[model samples]
Target chain A: MKILIVGGGMGGTILANNLARRLASELRSGKARITLLSASERHMYQPGLLYLAVGRMTPDELYRDQASLLEHDIEFHVDPVEEFRLDNNEVRTKSGKVHGYDILAIATGSRPAPEEIPGLAENAEQFYTEESAIKMFRRLQAFQGGRIVIAMGVPHKCPMAPLEIIFMLHDYFKDRGMLDKVKLHYTYPIGRVHTLENVAKWAAPEMDRLGITYETLFNLKEVDGAKKVVRSEEGGETPYDLLITIPAHRGMEVIEKNGLGQRGWIPTHRHKLTMEGRNNVYVLGDTTNLPISKAGSTAHFEAETLGENIAAIVKLGAPVRDYDGKVFCFIEAGKDRATYASFDYQNPPQPKAPTRAVHWFKVAYNKLYWASARGLL
Target chain B: MARRTVDARGSFCPGPLMELIAAMKMVAVGDELEVLSTDKGSASEIPEWLRKARHEHLGTEEKDGVWHVLVRKAR
Candidate 1:
């Protein structure tokens, strides 16, 4: 069996590692082969980007060479996939090289679609990418204190990040003795601060205590950088000295170009994680059009089920496992305190109060992330 | 009962933990290493790591807003 895994992000790496470990016997006997295709040699620790934006981490600490994360048994290709020929069971890369696969897993992650929202590409700052996070950090250092808006578009990746950024800002300004001068505003498209009701219940009181204004149902419509104002589709407008936004998110263009995606994301079975109308192909992580937060932890959890299913299908001819939509995320409150929440499709997350212990756990998880890619954690 | 002290103050989460792990690699078995960190997570995480790694955790103490964690390399 020849398996091709696309995208080297959290989902791809974890799946590759899990499959390689579980199918070691078949792999060593030449009955199975795994090939991982990625566009870049760099594997980013995305959660670290939040700390990077606050000037607490450096870029060197946030990324690692992808080669270091893979084992010797898997073939790693550092080439961009140009298109998927699902009808022929083949994948074409940007270099025009074609690879055949018996099984294909599309783990290609999502990216910030600033173009979806007017003026966001040019006007607002974001922490979703390494470059933008660094830019936000520099801008934050020079901020003289005024209205700062952290806005979001619906279905964005890492649903908890904007809230974490706001909390960090609260501590940053308080430490600098400029908390009184800075007016912090957090705007979301939904009716609540968080998608998870339990998380919102835990976070709302904290936001009130920090003196940060939480505005709900304020979907971003346009950003006027020159005028320093942001208008919501609901006819609400807020002026800001600085705007940090979680822009609209969409899957990679290649998926859409190949007609394998709906609105730039591959449609998959909610529990089976199998691509719709394609039995040999599967999808996970941000690439799938699932109503789940596009977080690294979500990918980690999804890989657990997806990996087992792939192994079973390869060995026994059918997948036996089903995904539960499990997800957990650590919410950084401020300073040294953090909280955590865990849930699945059936149950809402019950979050714990912020504490220094949970903060450290998040920190340790970042370090363990390196080991995780190799299937050690 | 520490022969070396690692000050990981002003650093964030895994920073303090990484420092302690690096310090442990340099010390001899049965030798003690103390970590001084301002990151509150270190107060709990360092001991957890020590227990998992099979190292002897002496204890953790807080002084002047800093956490002083003691660990002995137990081989």
Candidate 2:
């Protein structure tokens, strides 16, 4: 069996490692082969970008050589898939190489589309990438004090990032002794401060306590960079000296170009973790149109399930088990305090009050994430 | 009668439990497994999962900030 995994993000990497281990004997006997193709040679710890924007972590600390993180037997490549010929059970890479597989897993991941919103890319400060994060940090450093408004769109990766950044900013200015000089306001596209009802309930009063003002039902219409104002579709305009945004997210361009699914998200089986109609093709992480948080943990759990089922199909002539849509994310409430959310498809997460101990654990997890990616933790 | 110790310390929430479940698959129906995890959620979650999977939860104890959850395979 030739197993091809496209995109070496968290989901693909973990799945590769897990499958390599479970099929070790088969691989040695030439009964199975595993290959991974990714866009970059460096694997980034994406959650570190938030810390990067706050000056808590540096750029060099967020990456490792992608090949170094993989198992010895797995065939790793830097050529990214440009076309997905699902009907032919193969994907064509940028290097004009087409690889066919008996079983395929697509985990191309999603990209934050700040350009989707007019004037957002030019005016607003975002920390979705390393360069943008560094720039945002520099902008924050230069501003002495003023109105800093947080604006965001829906269906973005890392559901807790907006809240985490807002809270972190409160502490950032507080530490700089400019808390009283700056007015922090937040605007969300939804009817509440967060997409999840419980999180929104917890955050509204927390913002009120911190004096961080918020306006809900505030869809981002456009930004007037010259006037330093952002007008919402809800007929409200907010002016600011600094604008931080979590722009809307869309799946990778390759997915759309290949006519796979709308907006890059391939229709996937929520439980089986397979492409809706393709039994041998698996969809994972932000690549799947599952109505779950596009967090690393979501990918990790899905990868685990996919690994077991694929290995079973090779050995048992059938597969067992299903992905339960498990997702766990730590909410960094501030620089020193944090909490977490744990839930599945049938259950919604009930986050607790933020605690300092949990914050330290999140700090530790930052370093431990590499180990997790290695499928050891 | 067989027993296995799965020391899953330093792992995050659900990871420890997942490791224990993987171990459960390799053991016999009557085998007992002890999972050691540092994540606070695992202390309760391991037993919760055992209950749902129809496995017998032997006991759970926390020692030096690490939790040890014991269970026996039922099916």
Candidate 3:
């Protein structure tokens, strides 16, 4: 069976590795041809970018050469996907190359589209992407004294990430002997500081301790770059010297252009990670609008299931296994401490709980995760 | 003499752990407590945590897609 997987991200790479192990016989005999395509040579651990923004992790630590991470059997194409034809089971590349597949996996991840919001793209700097994070870091470093605003965009990955960065920034300035010279402001569209009110209960007081000013329900509409002003949906304007926007996110345009998006995300069954209304197509990682939060740990859990299910289909045609939308994440709160939140989402409301020990647990887990990614653990 | 049940099903990982910590706070010594966790990780995590905290591990069983982890306040 010819398996063509688009986007060599955390999901795509893990799926490829898992398939290689599960279908070793098919892969060795040339019966199964696996092709993984990506737009870049570097596969970055995006979650690490938050640490990079605050000088906690180096850029080199956040990314690895994709070819080095993959097994020898899987064919790697460092090219962008132009279009996909579901009827023929073929995907066309940006260079006008088309490849056919017996089965397909589209893990093409999402990206921030600042242009969707007028003036924000041209004027306000963003910190989601690697380049933007690095640029914002430089901007932060050069700042002698001024008002710094960290604005949260809606539906972004890792919902609590922006607050973490802001908190770290507060700690950063205090250490630099410029705490009083700079004023920090946070603008969020949500009713609370974080996703859960209980979380905000803890985080709000932390923000207060740092003397940071935050305004909620302030939906960012536009930015007047020339005037250094941002207009919110509530007919209010906030001016700043530096505007670090989280920016809006969407499924990779290729998925949308090919009619893959059901509701701004690839529609997949909760348990199987298989396209709900389609045959022989599976999606993992951030592109799928699952019930859980979009985070790297969710991708890992989904990859573990989808990879096995696909192999079963290729071999014995076993019924697909289900993914329970498990998410394990670390919410970094400066001082080299991180909180681990594992969400097991099911039907019927259940009270949520948070733990302080999660801070140390995340630090230890980070070491293990990177080690495992490099095949060391 | 009495048991307290914390329904943490439908919540995610550390959610069950947090519930256990909170429940331990309110329960008297030797009181039984049950945590219904939907997260598979919790099945293992809770047992390990209880052992470390010197609490008595009653048992764990999967029911209706959730793991019912029962523990007793031993400390």
Candidate 4:
């Protein structure tokens, strides 16, 4: 059996590692082979990008070579996928290589589509990638303390990241003794400060205490970089000396080009994680059009279920596991403190108050994540 | 027991743990090393790691909002 996994992000890599361990006998006997096709050689610890933006971590510490994370049994292909020939059970890469697989897992996670909103690419800065986070670090160092606006473009990965960035900024400025010189503002497209009601309620007083002006129901329409203004669809406008925004997120163009996505996101069964209308194809992580936070923890939990199911299907001819849509997130609350929330499709997360211990846990998790990529933790 | 102190206060998690492990390498067997960290998780995690590594855990104490963890290299 040949298992072809696309996109070597958190989901793809973790699933590959899990499969290699579970199917070790089959792999050693040449009964099954796993091939991971990734566009880049580096696998980034995306949650660390927030710390990278604030100078807490360097760029070198944020990622590892994808080859280093994969087991010897799994083959790594550094080629971009051009198209998926689902009807023929074949995948064509940009390098003109066509491979046939018995099982296909689409783990090609989403990317920030800055072009989705007019002028956003030119006006706002983002911290989603290593380069952008480094740029934000330099821009922040040169900032002279004026109005700073942090906005979200909706459905972005790591929904808690923007909030963490804002809190870290507060601590950064306060440490520099310029807290009073700068005014902080946050705008979200949703009706509340956060998608989770419990989190928003817990964060309301904290935002007020930090002197941050929180605005909701502000959908980003256009950015006027020259005028240093961001206008909402409702004609609401906010001006800033610096703008840090999370751009709109969409699935990879390759998936969309192959007509596999609904509005650029792959549609999958919420619990089964199987691609709609396909039995052998499964989808997980940020690429799926699930109403869940596109965070690493979500991918981690989903991988657990999907990995088990794949193993069962390959060996027993049927899937025996189901994903619960459970997600966990650690929200950095500044002052070296953090909070965590965990929930699934059936239960709403009860907000836990921020604490110093939680902050340390987030920090420790970053190190554990590297081990996890190698299937050691 | 003479103890050498490794002050890792204000450093993030794994930072303190890594510092403790590095400090352990420099110390002679039976010598104690104390790590001071403000990262709250280290208060418990350091000892857990020490136990796994077969080091003698002297215990942990919080002083002035900082955690002081002591361990003696056994191997």
Candidate 5:
């Protein structure tokens, strides 16, 4: 079996490792081949960026070379995916190299692009990506303090990220004794901090306590960089010296270009992650609209099921595993504490509990989870 | 050596680790702390972490699908 996986981030890496280890016997017998494709040589730990932006996590902790994450048996191609030729069961890279597979797994994660926002593209910065977020983090440290606007472009990845940023910024400025000069403004389209209402109820008190100015249900229509003003869909305008934004995210263009994507994402079977319209094709992680948080933990869960289902599909010719869409994310609130929340597709988010222990868990789990995926643990 | 039970059941990830740290602080050396966790990741991860931290991993037993892991504070 030739298994070609596109996108070598959380989902792709996990799938590659799981299959490589589970089918090691088959692989040793020359019965299986796996290929991982991605555009970058670097694999970033994105959740760390929330900490990285506030100097809680070092830049080195947030990125790793892609080859380090995959198993030795899986062939990795560090190049951009240009198109997916479904007819031939092949994916063509930007270099025009075409490789055929019996089964294709698309895990090409989404991109955080703010170019569509008026002045946001020109002046606003994002903490969603490594390069841009690091620049903004550095810029924030040098700032003596000004009107800091942490806003979100619609459909931003990880809806709670901007909220976490503001909370940590409060702690950062408070530590520097410059809290008086810094005014934190948070604006998002959702009526609350997160898409889930129950979470917002619990989080509202923290924003109030921290004195962070937040306006919910406000759409970001435009940003006037020169004037330092941000206009919302409701015609509300706010000014800022710096804009840290979570931009509008879109699926990989190659998938859409190949007619594999619907709107900004590829459609996949809710449980199996199989491509909706294509057989022997699977998609996972943020590349699909799975009604789950586009998070690493969720990807881990999906990878577990997807790997099993794919193996069963090839052997028994049946999809056996179903994704529960479960995800657990630790939200860092500075002050050496974090909150834990678990969300499943079938149920409401469970109540969250904040503790210093969760904070340490977040710190340790980051390393442990990374190590586990690479089998370092 | 004495044994103290940390009721970490229903606690989320990393919470167990933190509770262990705090419990270790309060107890004397050579004391054993047993953590009962419902999170599958924590149940598996705690023993490996104890080994790496040079703490003694007494054992991990499963009951009704819940995990009970015991560790002796070596430090």
Candidate 6:
């Protein structure tokens, strides 16, 4: 069996590591092979960027060498796939090499497309990338503090990020003793404060307690940088001294170019985690249009199930289980306090009040993410 | 047979639970397993999983902040 995993993000890394471990004997006997092709040599703890934007974490702490995180038996390469030939069960890389696979898992994650909205990218501070995160931090530092507006668009990759960043901003400003001078405003594209009803219920009060004002049903239509204002699709406008945003996200261009999915999100079978029509082709994480949060833990849990099933395919010629739509996310409420939501298709998460213990756990997990990529945690 | 103990003390939610589930697959029916976790979430989640998976719940105890959830493979 030949397994080709594209993209070394959370889902791909965990799946590759999990499969390598489960098929150790098969790999040793030359009965199975695992090859991972990634666009970069480093794996990033993406959630750390939320902290990075707020100066809680440094850049160096968010990365690990991708090769070092993989098992020794796995064949790893930095050649990114340029073309996907699903018809041939192969992919062509940027280096003009074609790799064939008996099984293929696509984990090409989403990217923040602030460029989708006019003036939004140029005016708003976003923290999706290393450069942008640092830039956001610098912008936050120089702010004289009037109103810091957090505007959001539909389908942001990490849906919880805008909320988390807003909370962290409260702490960051409080730590700087600028709480009285700064007014925090948040706007979401949903009917509620959050898409998750329970999370909205929990967070609305938290926002109120912290004196953070919010507007629901507000979408990022455009930003008029000259006026220092953002206009919503609902025909409302909010002025800001500083604008921080979680822009709408789109999956990789390669996926779109390959016609694998619309706007790069492949239609996937929710329980099977397979491409809607293609059995041998699998989709995970933000690459899948599953109507779930594109959180790293969603990818992690999906990888766990995909790994087990793929390993079973090698050992038993059939998969044994289903994905069950499980997702878990830790919501950082504010300074030294956190809560989490764990839910599936059938269950909606009712996040309890924030606690210091859960906050510490999130702090610990930031360092432990490397172990998780290696499928140890 | 003595009940097997899976020490997951340092791991958090889903980590300890995933470890326990992975270990359960290797054990035989009627085999007992104990999951030791410090995660408050997993301590509660494990018993719920046992109930849903139709496994026999032995007991759960918390000592010094670590939760010990015991179960027996029913099928």
Q: What's the lDDT for all of these models?
A: 0.82, 0.86, 0.74, 0.82, 0.74, 0.85
**Model 4 agreement with the true structure over A280-360: per-residue lDDT tens digits:** 898988888666678788788888788788889879998897787688889999859999888776566787889999999
Question: lDDT per residue, candidate 3, A204-319, as tens digits?
Answer: 88788778988865667788988998887545689999888887677787787777873247877766677867787888888885545566777777777777788988898774
Which candidate gets the maximum DockQ versus the true structure? 3
| Candidate 2 error regions (>4 Å) | B1-75
Q: What does candidate 2's lDDT look like per residue over A1-377, in tens digits?
A: 99999989999999999999999999999999999999999999999999999999999999999999998889999999998888898989999999999999999999998887788899999999999999999999898999999997656788789999999999999999999899999987544687555777899999999999998757677899999999875577999999999987888999988888777878888789889889999999998866667889899999999999999999997779988878899999989999998887556678999999999999999999999888777
Kindly report which residue stretches of model 1 are placed more than 4 angstroms away from their true locations once superposed.
B1-75
Candidate 1 is graded, for docking, as incorrect
Q: Return model 6's CA RMSD, one decimal.
A: 14.1
**Against the hidden reference, what TM-scores do the models get?**
0.82, 0.83, 0.77, 0.82, 0.80, 0.83
> Regarding lDDT, does 1 or 3 come out ahead?
1
Winning candidate number (lDDT): 2
DockQ value for model 1 = 0.01
The CA lDDT at A145 in model 1 is 87
Tell me the interface RMSD of every candidate, in Å. Answer: 21.3, 16.4, 15.0, 22.1, 18.5, 16.2
Question: Model 6: how far is A246 from its true place, Å?
Answer: 0.4
**Cα lDDT, model 1, residue A329:** 80
Off by over 4 Å in 4: B1-75
lDDT of 6: 0.85
DockQ of 3: 0.06
Model 4 has a DockQ score of: 0.01
Candidate that beats the other on DockQ, 1 or 3, i.e. the better one:
3
TM-score of chain B of each: 0.91, 0.92, 0.93, 0.91, 0.85, 0.88
